[model samples]
Target: MAGQSLGTILGRAFRLRCPKCGGGRMFSGLLRMHDRCSECGLVYERDPGYFLGSSYVNYGFTALTLTPAYVTLHYAFGWTNTQLAFPLVGWVLVFPVFFFRYARALWLGMDVYFDPQSFEDPAESEQPEPPVR
Candidate 1:
């Protein structure tokens, strides 16, 4: 698959099942990854260099998902900015460590399912695709 189906993609974003086959579990636990998909032979490690992007993803997900929650909690609980932000921001700051491993695994799986050339056999690198007529 060039990419997983929409349901699978959402599941991936939610850190759910394997995106390709959509049935097997992707993570060994909350943040640990299986070396390969039980359903498809998708290797969990797409590139050792890939996870460098995990920081940015972790930050983005944090901002998108948590910022509104932070604001809402402040209003709902009658929390002063300092009162709310202190502990909440501290929690937000720590969220990345807990999230990074899953995010790194996500980046790897994304490269696998979404990268056009990802699943192609590296041994055939010298071969060319048939030219369109």
Candidate 2:
């Protein structure tokens, strides 16, 4: 299959579809993801520590989004740090959980976009070479 555009990949990621096929469902449940894409059979986990990168995405996204809101509320509305503590803590805790799937999906999609070979069929890539004899 030809490569998809960045927009298409991001769209698939946001929708939680397989980044390769964009048709198969990415997750079987809220936190449980399938081993591979149902439609294209592309493996989701590239390595044991693959999904750890998604935690960075989650943290960066939370910080980038919430920092603006926090600064605005603190300066413009004169909200005290104590007053915002509970809500900020709750948002920090909850947003990561809510965004977990998407963060992982987006991370995978971005990786696939940059490293196209990673998404190729394993069977195709694993063919044995002919003997030199």
Candidate 3:
């Protein structure tokens, strides 16, 4: 794990593999994720709503990549906003769906990189309980 580089982790993310082992698959279906990694037994979801982070990833990716293209086409190419609107809207809606798995994978990879302890065995690590209010 220490020997792995950022590129390696990102590559694994692009491949949709388990961020830790880079062997087990990250998803079971289009939007369904395997509960844990098959190779390393890493849990995909640390808590309920964990995937909310991935939604932000998906949104940021879509906005960052598409916004520039839209601006370029509209201003430089002289395409009308009406012409760009449909395709841009469709892209914003559709691309996120396609990118869902990758976003989650990337999010997981980022988390694993920043929080190395997340890669620890679940049995060995103690899960923090929610505060009782």
Q: Which candidate is the best by TM-score?
A: 2
For each candidate, what TM-score against the reference?
0.65, 0.88, 0.86
Off by over 4 Å in 3: 1-3, 122-133
Error of 1 at 116 (Å): 3.9
lDDT score of residue 54 within candidate 1: 70
Best by lDDT: 2
Error of 1 at 44 (Å): 1.2
- Give the range where candidate 2 is weakest over 10 consecutive residues by summed lDDT: 118-127
lDDT of 1 by residue, 22-126 (tens): 666767776677777788676766667656887788888788868787778777767788777677778788888788766775665566556636665566455
lDDT digits (tens) for residues 1-133 of candidate 2: 4567899999999999999989999899999999989998888997898899999999999998789979998999999999999999999999999999999999999988888776777776686999999
lDDT of 3 by residue, 40-111 (tens): 878889899998999999999999979898989999999999999999999999999999999999999998
- Estimate the TM-score for candidate 2: 0.88
Clashing pairs in 2: none
